[model samples]
Target: MNLSVSLASGEPIYQQIKEQIKRQILSGELREGELLPSIRHLAADLNISVITTKRAYDELEQEGLVASVAGKGTFVTEKNKEAIREVKLRQLEEQVRSLAAESRMLGLSKQDVIGLFDLFFGEGRH
Candidate 1:
């Protein structure tokens, strides 16, 4: 999986790494059982400390999104994929619900919301 860390962002590097990896898994870009880069290697690649990458992986494991073997490296857990999917789906629904509430408060019509979605979701600048 491709990953990058932004030094300019106020968020912690470990959190940025964790969130991106989670997004990739939830979006089906990172398949189940896929092997992730070693923590040291990932830290080197991102120019961050090994502790940061390790923290990110540890958090993922704690959430049951990834598994680590004694002699092997970290890999995505097939068994927990569905659970992760459900969690991600619920998070997305909550975000959409919040947006809908805000739109209503702003007096935006359904068509206005649809237009905003189309404008942002459609093919354009990446």
Candidate 2:
């Protein structure tokens, strides 16, 4: 899986790693049973500590998104479709909440938000 970290993003490095990996799994970019990079190797590649990568993988395991095979590396797990859907829905809800707050700060109405959304959502359709 492709991953990157941004020190300026204000999120912890492990969280950035965990979230990208989760998104890849949820979107099927990382398939079930695909082996993730070894912790040390990934850490070296990202120029971060192995401990950070291990923590990210641990969080993923706790979320049931990946499994460790002892001697082997971590791999993606077969997910429950409903659970993935719920996760995505929650993410969308959070994005909408942020958008709503930002729009209110800019004095934009609900209709204004909908109009902007429609404009962007339809940009590629046409």
Candidate 3:
């Protein structure tokens, strides 16, 4: 697992690490059943505190993305494609809801937001 913590980012370092690792897992870059580096090793690699790495791993475990075995190490959990898709869909929906709220706060109509989305994504499709 590769992670680069952005100290300049407003997000907590552990959250940044957790998000990157989660993205890797979702993208299939980090295969299921693959062992992740030890928390100490990962902390040293990222030049962060062990507590930060532990927090990231704890969140992953809570999300069922990784499992830890006593005396062994943390490993990615095997997930069905449908299950992964559902998880991703839920996450996306939450983000979309937040964005919609922000748009509403900015006085953007639903149609205007849809148009902006189409313009932004449609351009990339072609």
Q: Please name the candidate that would achieve the greatest lDDT relative to the true structure.
A: 2
lDDT of 3 by residue, 45-96 (tens): 9899999999999999988899999999999999767868987999999999
Name the 10 consecutive residues with the lowest summed lDDT in model 3.
117-126
TM-score of structure candidate 1: 0.77
- lDDT by residue for model 1 over 1-126, one digit each (tens)? 899888889999999999999888877898889999999999999989999999999999998889998779999888565787688789989999999999999999999999999988967776
lDDT of 2: 0.94
Which ten-residue region of model 2 has the weakest summed lDDT?
Answer: 117-126
Candidate 1, after superposition: displacement of residue 50 in Å? 0.5
Regions more than 4 Å wrong, model 2: 111-126
Candidate 2, 1-126: lDDT as tens digits:
689999999999999999999999998999999999999999999999999999999999998899999999899988878878888899999999999999999999999999999889977674
- Candidates 1 and 2 compared: the better one by TM-score is 2
TM-score of each: 0.77, 0.83, 0.76
Residue 20's lDDT within candidate 3 is: 94
What's the count of clashing pairs in each model shown? Answer: 0, 0, 0
All-Cα superposition RMSD per candidate: 5.0, 2.5, 3.0
